[model samples]
Target: MHNSSQPRTDAPSAASEPVIEVRGLAKEYRVFDKPEGLMASVTGLFNRKSRVVEALRGVDLRVEKGEFVAMLGPNGAGKTTFLKLLSGIITPTRGSATVLGSVPWERTDDFRRRFALVMGQRNQLWWDLPAAESFRLHKEIYRIDTPRFERTRDELVDLLDVRKLLLRPVRDLSLGERMKLELVAALLHEPEVLFLDEPTIGLDVVAQHALHRFLAHVQAERQMTVILTTHYMKDVAALCKRLVVVTQGSILYDGSLEQIVDRFTSHKIVTLDLDAPPDRAAIDRLGFPCEIRGPQVILRIDRTRIADVLPGILRGQGVRDVSVEDVPLEEIVAEMFRSGSTAGTDGATGAPR
Candidate 1:
């Protein structure tokens, strides 16, 4: 039987090397023009024109063993394209990528055995059959020995909390329940690397939190390398210590989330709730830019001047309640893209503060 405590080293290793190495990875798709009218359609069929949609343009990435990294970007920002290239689902048109020292698109049996890709929107389990049965079938497909399969399956079920739901048909399970089963099935063989594409997508808050905890546990206990692509900023912020932010088919901000915030915005929103609406002139006399919205007074205080400006606003306004908060990450990122602030260092690339 496989031991839960032992590290899985079944895959081929090139002198205990990095799990993944990518350089100048790029992919492009031909954009076909739709015919304007019936005559144009008939003509276009005969003489078609196309444009290049650069899904991923020269993305340079490297992932080490046992490191959990998150890839974040808005829709159509090349995050999915990059994951597909790494998983060998789609081949990159340029550059090179190696997973466990093997070319991803090569379809080698050894390489296939060493990794698992779990896509949240895609269902891998059989709809009609019990999830346990599907897992058993996959165990055979993976050729996992009885002892090893039992040990891994049991461990995954316990960790993912899907033991009771395993015998139920996959189609009958709730979204959260199905996700739990999917996780167990994917990890049944203890793949060295796990690629999660929106693994927490479409889940409720509680379900999302559950999955997040499970992922954290799996990372800590197994020491497996994971490359996650997620649009949910909360998932990225909570799980990922390092990150790569891709936009317009390129790596735009590839550092810490905190760095992104710090570099993009210097304005802090400080809210002060007053017992009564304060005078506009009195609020402005504090010498800081302030806005009165409802019963609250907000200040657009600069990061450098927040300390000096905050106390004055409260003391001057006779504040009943006060709060200090950095601008949301989403707003900062939006501003960065809108202002065209691409290709610059923010700060720590290793992890978020």
Candidate 2:
């Protein structure tokens, strides 16, 4: 039901261009204090008090043309707010952001045509009408030509496997199927930048995996710049190399996934399958507590202490099998959040620790 007013189109990028450039981006909301009762309501209209809620503190970020980046954070970590700033949905109270060579808040015709926003919970399509109608609406709003629109639409429909669901009312489709259609509608114009907020929020395990695979395929095929906000670590591990961890309106860590493990953890889980219960004193000498269950002994060993201690554990003839492994990414991220790492650090560079 809407269309962006534009003059002419421009050429695509060279793949090395910086698609998103942000500096000291911040947003704050003035939340008014309200009181109960009719008298309070009347007085509030004339002289109401309010408090400033800083949803996003001074944050700096840069995303390359085709890089897939994951923005990780707790429940209220300003991840969504950051996306709004970059996508031009809202204006920043302070700082500047340049997305695709234009200020996002300007909401220019060029920017609107080149990017798409897909929120998992928010339904942009009509509830009573079929998804096909929504796709048609998007085409009209974006001013896509007939041949180009059909080609892109059919290609996305085939790639996402949503051809059968096109005729069904959006309200009737299953969550997974509906989500696929949503992505189809978002990408019909072949956008260069995609801002995805919790795209796999409530889908089942199988559906979640399918959606992730489809996203990987779409990104690879189209070379789109993607900014994904997610709590799911599996998505980060599978699809994203650059992770930006945010907490309490601040960037705690901005680096590669490997570097996060290195900077945060210094120990590995060493499990021993004991032929018989080991002497308690043997488990005690490792300097860390051992989790004992019947005959198997689970030891957490510091990387440095492993060389000194492994020989002693193996010397015990009762040892059946010993396995050493790095701590899992889930556990590492949980540990980082446990420490309440909301204080600001240098994240603008998107560099390793």
Model 2: residues with Cα > 4 Å off, grouped in runs: 1-16, 34-47, 276-281, 341-353
In model 1, what are the clashing residue pairs, if there are any?
none
Q: What is the lDDT of every predicted structure here?
A: 0.77, 0.81
lDDT of 1 by residue, 157-206 (tens): 88777788988899999999998888888888888999999999999999
Per-residue alpha-carbon lDDT of model 2 for 53-95, expressed as tens digits? 8788777766787888888888888999989888889999988
CA error at residue 140 for candidate 1, angstroms: 1.6
Q: Candidate 2 at 120: error in angstroms?
A: 1.6
Superposed Cα RMSD, model 1:
7.5
